[model samples]
Every structure is written in structure tokens, then in C-alpha cells.
Target: MQQVFVFLILACVSSPGTPKSVDVDTDDDVLTGLEKKTLELETQIAGLKTEICALEMKMKEERDSNQNQLKGVSANVSDTMKVVGDHTAALATLRLDIDSLIQSVNSPPPTPAPTDVSVCPGDDWVEHNGHCILFSSESVTWNTAKVRCMYYGAHLMVVDTEELNTFLKIRLRAPDGNSHYVGGIDFGQANWIWDSTNTEIGYTDWRISQPSNGRTEHCLVVCSGSTCQWNDVDCYGNKKYICQKAAVHG
Candidate 1:
């Protein structure tokens, strides 16, 4: 009976001590799961780092491109401003040159030589080139002036050449400020002819808008200023005249 009791006690105590190998296997499984999770996390972190590096490189490239564009725009604006400044300066210089040219144009010309009185017929006559010219003081109509010149054995002055016209303009600088009658007359048909020579005057110095073709403007007269341009006026209107004759040769 004592031996039977001892066997029962041994059977109760010999239950495998709570399975130490199963515990060891469970611990190994947990360590393997933890290692797998750690490996996955490390892979994810490495991918993120690569993505971040790529993003950083793209941002740097874009920034460099924007800076280059800004520099190009700035350079273009600077060049445009320089061109504008140069144009403004050139315009200013051109204006000054125009003003100087206008002043020079308005100034009077130099005086010519004295009249050769030896070739003229009388004290009132002046010799130039080959002609004797007389400036009349009395104002008269075109027909009356021609008649008076004919009585003096002369004709109304004819400006046949540039030299003769220039001579007359220089000599006609009398301070009386009177515009003188010439021999030019357009006989109601727009065809101008010198009455004395019955021909076209070869040289002409008309005013800017002379020969306005007014109803009665048929006679020509030298203007009153230093610029001795010609103008057509009414033949009936009275004006001082110039007479011309061939110079006497000794």
C-alpha cells in the first residue's frame, strides 16, 4: 500500500515542468517577427531618403533656372534704357543744329563792291555787268512807269541772269522799305513774260508763295526785305520801278 502511494505521488510530480521547449520556440518566433518588422521599416526609410534627395535636386535645378531667367530680363531692360538715352541725346543735338541753321539763314549776307559809275550815263544810274540801271523814286502804275522809262530812252528792268538779279538786290537795299516793280507781267493767261524783251526772264527769285493768281495780280514786284524775292501784284497798283539801258562803251 505504501508503494502504491509512492507511484501516485511520482505521477503527479512528473508533468514535464510546464514545457520549456515550447516557451523557447515562442520566444524565437517573436524575435523573428520583430526582426522582419525592423527590416521593413528600414527599407521604407531608405526609399523616403531617396525620394527626398531627388526632390531636393529638382528644386535646386528650378531655382537656378529662375535665377538665370531673371538675369536675362534684367540685361534686356538695361540695354533698352541705354538705347532710349542715346536717342534722346541725339534728338537734343539735332534740335540745336537746326536752331543754328535757322539763325544762319536769317542773317544778312555780306556787302558787294561799289557801283561802277564810269560806265553809267548819269549820276542816278548804276552800272552792273553790262547794264545801266536807274531806280525811280516816284510810284506809278505799270503802264505809266513803262512810258516814263521809254521817255528816258530805257526800259523797265529785266532780271535776265542770276548775276544781274543779285546785283539789283544788293543795290536795292534802300532804307525806304519800298517794294519795286519789275518788268515781269502775266498778261491775263498765267504766262509770265518780260514786257521790255517780250520773252521769258531766265532767272527767277519768287517768294515762298508768290504768284497767288489773284483776279488782278498780273504784275511782278521785288519784295521789300533783304530777301529780295519776287511777287505778282495788281498791275494798276502803284509801285516804284527800276529802269535799264545798255551801258555806253568808251
Candidate 2:
């Protein structure tokens, strides 16, 4: 409208009946000024768009960088968790080993008793020195008597000396007057041996010609006396056997 008004004014001024002067020059200058202003506004808007693009790109870069860092951190945490799990397992194994070692180091050691204990709950088996002795008066086969003694967790008696003989004299069966079977006779090797054990023969009270290695004598028997000794006899001959076990036969 202003340009139109200027044109009308110029038209009027330049009319054949009218006169022209500096008005035209001033209007042209105003038009030039408006055009310059428009150009400047456009330049400023373009600069703003460029700056916005740069900022958006920078923001995107930062976001991507942060996400990458987060990923790294997450990976590190996963690795750390795995390491912790491994360490926990190792600690558990170490604890188990430590417990085993503690048990091995702190547990009680076995005593040097000849026999650890007797199965007879009532203390029926006599405990003398370190040996647990059980005397049987009922006449039985050598094997049967031995089995009975073992049922009580013992074996046939082992008479080593006159002292042991005297100790067993009180336990002997006098009513039957039957010589009991005692652990002796190495007839397996044609010599005297404690059939109850593979013990090194320490003490022996061999009656004269007692172990004659006779065919009828496959076993040995004992009686109480300073001259108490092993007598060879048939293994099948039933008698009251003296069954004994060591108190601490270590």
C-alpha cells in the first residue's frame, strides 16, 4: 500500500498538468532501504538455522558418546560380577579345604589302648591292664567258643605267662573239669602260634613235650599254674574255651 501510494503520488507529480521534484528520489531511497532490511533479515534467519543444525549435531554426538560409555560401564559391571562369582566359588572351596584342615589338625588322636573298647555294655568283659578278657565256662567246640567270643567282639584267650595263668585261674570252669582251648599252637607252621593274632611270640610257658606236633593234636589248651603251659590236642575236642581280647591292642 505504501508503494502503491508512492506510485500514485509520483503519477500525480509527473501528471502533465502537475510538476515533479525530489519526492521521487526520496521514495526510491525508502524502497531501497526496505529491500536491504529484508535481505538482512533473511541472512540472520539462515545463520540461526545453521547454528541450530550445529547444536543438534553436537547433541546427537554427545548422546551417542554417553550411550557408548554406558555400554562400556555395563560390560565392566558384568565382568565384575563374573569375577565376584568366581571369587565366591573359590572362597567356598577354600573354606571347605580350611574346614577339612581344621578337622585334621584339631580332631582327637587315637589312644594306645590295646582294645579301644568292649561291646559288652554291662562291663561284663574284665579290663585288666590294657586287655579285655572274657572267660567262658560253658563247654563248646573250639570254633563255637571262638565264634561266641567274637560275637562279643573278642577272640579265644592268649596265655603268655604264669601271671596270666593265675589271673585266669579264678575264671576257669572247675565243675566241668574240662581243659579250655587257649590261643596257641603254630601247627600251621608246625610250631606254637597265637591263633588269635599274628603277634610276635613274646612270652610262652611251654610244658615239657607239650606241643609234640602229634597228629591228634591240631590245637592247644591251657591251665592255671607256675607250670601252666600249652597242651596239643585235637581241634574237634569240645571244651570250655578261654576267650580274651586286648584292652588296647594297638
Candidate 3:
């Protein structure tokens, strides 16, 4: 509008007598050029606004995608922690169970109360050390004595302790001396093993210089001497035997 006013003033000054129609025509041409430039600038501004809006929308979408991925990662982390916690609890419980099992294994078994000798199964049987023992008066070979004891649902006596050995020595004492077969036998290994359980004998009452025969003397016998010590002997020798069985509860 200013340029239009300026051109009008110039035309009036430079040509006072010029035709008013020509001046008005020149003013119209200038107004048309300014309008075209204004339109072009407005169009460029509109295109720039559209581009800014597109860029903002794209940035917003990217931000939302990143947020969603973060949420998924957080959820996976929570789930992994939960699983780890569960395993930790299970491991703690298993450790407790193992400790309990170890304690049970290490604890000793309860000892039963002592029983009276009168409660033995028969008149010929004697109660000693939680067992009922029968001392056979008849003599037999070691193998035959073992079979005879089995016939009575018993095994040859196994004296595993010093007290039991002393008790048997007193019980087997008689005016006429006689040897008795016990449970021990060497099964070609040179180590004396109890026939009752096939376990190596851990206790013995061997007399001085006895068991000197090595493999030749494969059987055990309780001698009738005053000391009533043990001696390795020939398995085929005839001897009285002792049989033993667990005592009846009732």
C-alpha cells in the first residue's frame, strides 16, 4: 500500500498534465505484483507448517514405541526375578530337608530295657544279652552243629562283647571239661567271620599263642579250661555247641 501511494505521488509530480487513466493503470500493475509476492510467501509458510507437523508426529510415534519396549523389558525382568525367588525358596527347603536327614542318620538308636532270664522260651534255654541261648549237651561236628542250630530256627552263638563272653564262660562251666563250638569260621580268607551274619568277627577271647595253625584251623571253639578262652580248631572235630536266637517279646 505504501509503494502504491508513493507511485501515485510520483505520477502526479512528474506529469501534472498526464492522462489520469494511464496513471491509474500503472498503479493497478504495481498492486498486482505485490499481491503475487504475498501469495507466494503465504504458500511457502503453509508448506513449512505442514512439514513441521509431520516431523512432530513422527517423533511422537517413536517416543511411544520406545515407551512400549521399556514396559515389555520391565515385565520380563519382573518375571525373571519371580522365577529366581521361587528357586531360591525351593533350595532353602531342600537344604533344610538334607539337614534333617543328616541329623536322623547321626542320632543313635534307642536301647531296649533289660529282660529276665525266667522269661526264656524253654527250660533248656537261658536268657542273656537280649537273646535265648541253648547249650547242646550232645557233641557234633562244626558243620553239623551249624545245621542243627538252623533246624531250631537259630544260629550258632556269637559272643561279640567281653560281658557276653564272661557270661557264657560261667554258664558253660561243668565238672567234666568239654569244648564247645561257636559261630566263627574262616571261609578260606584267613579272616575269621561269624557264620550267623557272615560278618568279620571283631571280638575274640583267644588264649595265649592260640590261632597259630593259620588256615589249617578253620573253626572256633570255646575251651573248657578255667579261663574259658577261645581256640581255633579243626572244623571236623566233635564238640558240644551253643545256639542262640532273639528272645520273644511277650
Candidate achieving higher lDDT, 1 or 2: 1
Q: Tens digit of lDDT per residue, candidate 2, span 94-181? A: 9999999999899888676675543433456777766777667587777788789888778887777667876765555365334778
Candidates' RMSD to native: 17.1, 17.2, 17.7
Cα shift from native, residue 65, model 3 (Å): 99
Listed in order, each prediction's TM-score against the native is 0.50, 0.44, 0.50
Per-model lDDT: 0.85, 0.74, 0.86
RMSD of 1: 17.1
What lDDT score is found at residue 139 in candidate 3? 88
lDDT tens digits by residue: candidate 3, 1-250:
9999999999879886667878899999999999998999999999999999999999999999999999999999999999999999999999999999999899997688775543567898888757889999998899999999999889998988888888887877656545799999987567888988999899888888877667568888885566678888888888999999998765
Which stretches in model 1 have alpha-carbon errors above 4 Å?
Answer: 1-118, 174-177
Per-residue lDDT, model 1, residue 112, is 77
Superposing every Cα of model 3 onto the true structure, what RMSD results?
Answer: 17.7
Q: How far is 22's C-alpha from truth in model 2 (Å)?
A: 99
TM-score of 3: 0.50
lDDT of 3 at 220: 88
Please, what are the lDDT tens digits per residue for candidate 1 over residues 164-223? 777777777655445788889988888889998799766788877777878899988885
